[model samples]
Target: MHFFFHGQESLSILDWILRAAVIFIFVIFTVKIMGSRAISQLRLLDFVIALMLGNIIAHPLSDHRIGLKGSVISTIVIVVLYLLGIFLSLKWPGLRRIINSKPFPLIKDGEILYKGLKRARISIDDLLAELRKEKVEDVKKVALAIWESSGEISLFLEPQFEAITPSFYQLQTEPFDLPQTVIREGRIDFSVLRRIGKEEEWLIHTLRSSHHTEINNILLATIDRQHNLQVFLYK
Candidate 1:
């Protein structure tokens, strides 16, 4: 605690450990307050704040003269400013446009837009690489490609090039459902089971009849909307 304010010429092992743990917890709390968007997907405003925070927080950890209090205060102020900026951008369209660049069409109707490419500051090779990532072998197959503000390329295949689905042939298909995990690591999730209108007794009986195993042996198990139970056992 004494070392936090007064500068130390050298830190002992315990001192270093204490400082690290304190900083680690502080950073986690700060990130939580800043919101998920700060780390998940960085945009223009996010990038600037991230850089500023990193530089500010890093000095306190390495330099003995730099106190944690100053860094913490600066971080809180920056986070507040960041939140305010986000709020303002959401309320004002002009400010939003200035902060977040508008998406521009890089390719349209199988033709590449050279002007858009120049505006985006990406080369032909870069465009080709992005196309390859989307599994597009030919540019002609792409109906539209936009350079998004998040530095992501959104590509759309031409109608003729798009893969056919069951709907295309007017064939009926089962409704989509996301399976819920009922048993994980040999433990039954009673809450999930009840939510799916099932009981532990029914699950145990089904496991015995279908998988020929008990709940304890199952590594993972899921039940879908159709009440289909799929079980995975430990290897």
Candidate 2:
């Protein structure tokens, strides 16, 4: 007693499920080919594209009146647009700025940026929740808090409120020397030696004096202001 479109049966639940699976696979494959990142670090525009993916599927899956082919085409179009935006952003800094917003200072030197908070559309409770994630109980202890465009929060504490180190006890602290690895997995870093104003001959001589005739036997070696040629040999 019932009639069907094009003399074929209306799409069933199984048909809908299969169509959804195919679309999902297609979307994932397309994203992978584009070298897209995971959703967690997604920017606002990226999140919107993700939601568009769901939007394309939701209606067709629920309503038999909606065509699956139409949904698939629409989803592809949206994805292509997203990919284009990503490409253009890389080429043009202006476009990149539009896509990824500038980092807003939520806190500066223990002072809250109320205007920025409002612009970011986050409540004080939301800000506190983010701080709590960093294990910061008191806002006054924080020196800087940045609202990154990627929806990540960065916190910096004042030096006075920073972690207690051996230097805190007035121990003989070495001058600030960037800890550079001079050797890793038995490979020497000649560039690091040049930066530290040391010669390859000096390093070879030092290793020989320490009874390390072969650089390949060394697992790690570091040079800093406080020490010279710290070598860790393989067991």
Candidate 3:
């Protein structure tokens, strides 16, 4: 009877360990399949979905009667659905529009759009709090405050009288598209150059002028829209 009890205890322990290992592997696989963006730029609905998914998986992972195979299968199905949503969003613009709507304008032309706030289901107090967080005290100072699809607030400051064009509030200083070095760590990034509207020749010339003989020697380099070159040499 003692030997039988010991055997049962061992079996229970082994079962728990097996279940834990399966749960860990499934969690890692699911997270990898979801991609890093899910954690970084999560929208309101995304957060809720993630929480619910965890809750659903937790029960099967913890309960001994709930088989590992079933849990893993369910996880795979969820991941497939997520991937399908992403693919559909990419393939169909209409689907993308429906799935991920454009930002709602909270403020426009230095005036607070109260109607837009009501449409977004956000109160005036919430809007004011967001503006304050963005360091915008007066609504008149804002060119536009958009409630992004990701549930993040974006602020665009009005142009000062001195600067004829409207300036984005994110950069309180001069608005410039600082040239970013797309190529680094011995890798070539043509996409970044295309983004800045420059060619290889221009980059080479700019580097040469800055006394950079080789791309490998450059630790960092950025070009602003104003054509200003900011370069950092390797230490």
Clashes per candidate, residues 3 or more apart or on different chains: 0, 0, 2
Give per-model TM-scores.
0.76, 0.52, 0.50
Per-residue lDDT tens digits for candidate 2, residues 51-125, read 667788898899987778766765766676677767888899997875566787889988899987875667899
lDDT of each: 0.80, 0.74, 0.64
C-alpha lDDT of candidate 3 relative to the true structure: 0.64
For residues 144-178, what per-residue lDDT tens digits would candidate 1 score against the true structure?
99987777789999999999999999999998889
Model 1 segments more than 4 A misplaced: 1-41
Query: Which segments of candidate 2 are over 4 A away from where they belong?
Result: 1-41, 164-235
Collision pairs in model 1: none
Best by lDDT: 1
Model 2 lowest lDDT segment of ten: 1-10
lDDT value for model 2: 0.74
lDDT score at residue 37, model 1, on the 0-100 scale: 34
Best model per TM-score:
1
* Comparison by lDDT, 1 against 2, better one: 1
lDDT of 3 by residue, 38-57 (tens): 44457423553475468658
In model 3, the Cα lDDT at residue 83 comes to: 67
Per-residue lDDT value at 177 in model 3: 51
